[model samples]
Target: MARHHTVRALLVGGPMYDSLYDRLPAFERATGLHVDVVDRLPHPELNARVKREFESGAADFDLISTHTKYAPSQATWLSPLDAELGAEIDDFLPQPRELSRIDGALLQVPRYLDVRLLYYRRDLLGGSSVTVPRTWDALIEAATTLTRPGIYGFLFPGRDSGLFGTFYELLVSAGGHLFDANLRPAFDDAAGVWAADRLAELHDRRGLTPRELPAWHYDEVSASFRRGEAAMVCDWPGSHHLYKARATCDVADRVGLALLPSGPAGIRAAYSGCHSFAIPRTARNRAGAVELLRDLTSTAAQLGEARRGAIPVRASALAQIRAEAAADPAEAHRWELLTRTQEAMIIPPRFAAYPECEDAIWHAVQRAMTGVVSPQAAVREGAQHIVALLARERLSPQPNTV
Candidate 1:
């Protein structure tokens, strides 16, 4: 694994990733692999840079940050890590341990993870008779009990990717799957119908959530929890720093994090992915790239990442994090919440058409949420739309950009 060449890296911003960003020089000194970090851009620019530079046939960086869902679509331009991986990957959390491959080629190593979790108002729940719901049925009971004059019980994503992920997770937790082994849509059956019914039930609840959830902005989804407008919410760990800030969040000290409530099938929800390190196939420093990835995603690195609010990718890092956060109850709760969520994780479908598929599915979920149609009816028609869309896509395959 020893390498002398410098590894040109382009990483994105995350509290945990900051450790790497701050200590690139030390990494080079210790490993003999100098890293020239390119501009540490915001997520959108970073993603665009990876695509644009690689597609332009200019391999400027050796190690580029990647994600599980969308990165698979660009796998052709990335080098496969199959030959380089070994027992080193054994201890990572399942969902974040491996990157999605476009066509059976492993193109990246997972670095850190993010998962959907429930954030509830601890102060409100303590006064009520309800405990955190462990199942969908229980959630309804809890939400109903919590709803009073000024506050709502639960909140979900109103628009954007959050809506899609939440809908997909509910579907999966209720024993429904979007695609079968044949890469064909498989969500039109009874399981799918049952899942939608559960979702619609929540949407139809009178005082349990926002009356005009569809009209609520996406940012308001999390803000509602912090401002005490909603008693419970489903959001990512990256937003934790903000939600727990005393100056910003009214419920800061009273915030409690929990795993997504269990569903009809008894499994909790986990719609998740990771930021990873990938080597472009056109890179001149293959050895250096692999060396850099190994060092960056090491167990120690993950532990350091967790201390700053980034969820770690490795299983062992969980215990390390709990120990480190022993003095901070809230941070310890985060680590515990993370472990529980990771156990419930099951990766979403990994295919190039997923973005379009997600949009199609979100539309149906929105229809149910807005009360235009019943969950059964929304899914029945949603499944039909997905199948038709996939069929059309197959007829005239869209070209890949990167």
Candidate 2:
């Protein structure tokens, strides 16, 4: 086989993940192998594109960005990494390592562990009598009290998987499971209704969020907070650097980090997963892909990303970041909150149809929030759609093994 010198890739591109791409020239210089980014889109778009490419049997890229939750859908076409990348896997945190595996096959190398934490404006909280909210109900109360003409009390991504993830975290925290042991839909119960109603209340009844919220995605929500438009937001670790950078954030000096508030069930839940890289079964440059994967997930690479506020999946990189953070009070406080909240992280059940399931639920939740449908109707209809989806998926042909 002729060896290809240029490795083609499709990657997740945005403020949060793009900084790592800056180091690609260095990889090229050292390895004498070029990294050609064939496509660079935000995660949701990237997921949709990858699905389209794979389904049409046109996944021509050598390597691509993937997520633990979405990996199962692409597992059949993903080349297992365990044989090609050996001891390097040993350096990853157990959760990330396990999340990257499917039926015991290592399918991806994790770039970061993503979990949402509460980001608030300390100045706003300090100026008001409202203390930091510790529960969902209390958060509602605080948000209502803090809301005014210029600023909304809370902000969140209102579309796509970001919206679904917000609802999933709240549903779990309210003691609702997404599915029963048999994999049937189980989110139409009272707890699920409660979760949906809370979002509706924020957007519809009380107007605690922007009127245009239903159209906003992750970047928009985070950007709103940076512009000093929201008092509080739940955001991933990747956005932490932007929140703290005075040059980009209007409220940078007033930023504060904390664990997400608990729900009625007394559980603090965060929808979480690992962002990773994987080689395609159709890769034209398999050797080059492996080398690039190693270079991208190396300790130094992870450390650089960690410094920019991404949570490193490599154990050594995490420890080094922690040690460095200990000297800075603000960074230390941020790490402390993240450490204490690990137990509260909620990873979704992996399945090939998971993205479709998210689509159904988020659209339902959005309809409810926008007052196009009642909360009860939304959950009930969403559950019904998922029941049919799962049934159809079960009857469909299983993916081919790599």
Candidate 3:
């Protein structure tokens, strides 16, 4: 039997900060292990710190948790888990696990998955003429119809890479490709232009908000919804729980969640990503570290995590989401909406040039949203920047199709 010991683990994430505080007691009581969590640093900062640890031979953590998006380039620093984890992985959803793999090697063990979802004030639209939109055109029309002074029709985060990435997901769902399999820029097409134009319309023509809307991140926009400042927003599952809290929600029963409107392909679409756990190569207790990961992702651990509304990595834990809902009607409906969004989720391709590409896209989208240039012009400029960066790296663009 594998011996359990005191495993020191470092978790790097934001959503489950409070959940961990409440849930870890049981874990420690059962295993006699103490977990340490480091919150607040962004992904880039954490990556830099990990690199420094390896360079200086000063290891500080045995296990690390991060977003699944970093797997492709960060694989070198991750310990291979296939030999240690065994067959328990068959319980996780297929797409998340597939994305966690690097060259057929398992790089991380996923825990919870997050995808984009639409949140709106049902009180404002519920009894009124407004209806929750299911297509891009319908959404635009609703935004125009429901918008008024002091209240915006639609709002989405557009700040920095978060905003740009969300918009790019819409472009992909709209039948656009960032690059071909050959690593060549393929975003300068009608689908790409349409995506940009749609966003610009929300800002300029639809009266959603001025250029200031894009500056808002997920938190800001979600707060606006809770405060009844925005009529519609595209957000994640966290907002559902955040709004349900008695102290935060102004319209607790009035919040309605739905899938993002379908795109040109008539498909419900959302940008899906996973927050996962990985063992670092510099760990002093490799075997113990792997056990920690297994413990965290096991059916029991995952079920506990899902009890607090986290989308667990393992499929068996999904049943917990339903059971919890059965006990709480509000939670049941919210989770049902989350499950719908999950079905529509698509994981973005991870590449070495992901950060650079994200930067270029952010800048380009900002210029277009501000009316400094047309959508076509902005996308053209963004594509050029991406091409230049790729050429410098002696690589080409390789966009993944969902």
Candidate 4:
């Protein structure tokens, strides 16, 4: 095969990930192989575009940014990396490494681990009697009491995968499962209703969130909290650096971190996964793509991102961060809370049609939160739609790989 000097890639772009791309120049300078970023959109848009390209047989990019939850759907078009990257894979943290594979084949390089934590304004909570809210009811009470003229009580992503993920964690925390023994939809039960009701109460019944929340995604929710417009938010680790940056955040010094509050069943579940990079089977510059993948996921690269608040997947990078955290009280508390919360992390079921299922659920959830329907009715409708979708796609529940 002729060696190609340029590699094209489709990447997920945002404030949280833009810093990593800033280092691409170093890679290009060292290897003399240019990287062309074909497209850079958020996760949902990137997923849709990649699906369209793959289905139309027009996937010309050599590499793409992907997440563990969406990898199963794209596995057919991704090239297996076991033989070429096995040694590098061995150094990754075990859970992230497991999430980077599909059906026992290493298909991607793990970049960072993502899990949601409750981020609040320490100034707001400290003066109040609310003591870090250990349960959902307690959180609601705190949020209600904290609501003021300019500040809303709570904030969360209201659409797309973010909304679906929020609902998933709440459902699991309530002692519910997404699927039962036969892989059927099991979220329409009482637990599901309870989860949906909480979201409804926050948005519609009590008006604790912004009026435009139904259209907001992860970025919007994070921005709202950074502006000090909300007292609390459930957000991912990727936003940690921004939350602490005095330049971008109004309440930077007042920020506080805590594990997610427990549900009625006493479970504190967090939606979690790893963001990664993969080579497509149709990649024109396979060698360059592989080399770029290795460079992007190297310990040095991961350490840079980790210092900026992302959870590194490489064991060495993680160790370095832990040592650094030991000396900083704030960093030490954040790291300890995140590590303990990992025990309650939950990932979506592995299946090719999972994205479609997520859409069905989030739409129903949006309807509930907007008062188009009751929580019970929304859960029932969402479950029915998922069952129909699974049948249409002829998909069976695949066992979890991690």
Which numbered prediction scores highest in TM-score against the true structure? 4
Task: Write one digit per residue (lDDT tens) for candidate 4, span 172-218.
Answer: 98999988876689999999999999999889999999999988999
Clash pairs, model 4 backbone: none
Candidate 2 lDDT tens digits, 178-248: 88777788999998899999999888999999988988999999999999999999998888889877887
Of 1 and 2, the candidate ahead on TM-score is 2
Would you list the rank order by TM-score, best first?
4, 2, 3, 1
Q: Superpose all Cα atoms of candidate 2 onto the true structure and report the RMSD in Å to 1 decimal.
A: 2.9
lDDT of 1 at 237: 66
Q: Which residue pairs collide in model 1, if any?
A: none
* Model 1 misplaced regions, further than 4 Å: 1-63, 82-95, 99-105, 144-150, 197-220, 241-243, 282-296, 315-319, 325-337, 392-402
The TM-scores of all predictions, comma-separated, are: 0.74, 0.96, 0.85, 0.97
Error of 3 at 33 (Å): 4.4
Predictions: Cα RMSD each: 5.8, 2.9, 3.9, 1.7
In TM-score terms, candidate 4 sits at 0.97
Over 193-268, each residue of candidate 3 has an lDDT whose tens digit, in order, gives: 8888888888866567644776676666777777777788876654456766657767666777776788886766
Q: What lDDT is reached at residue 35 by model 3?
A: 58
Error of 2 at 236 (Å): 0.9
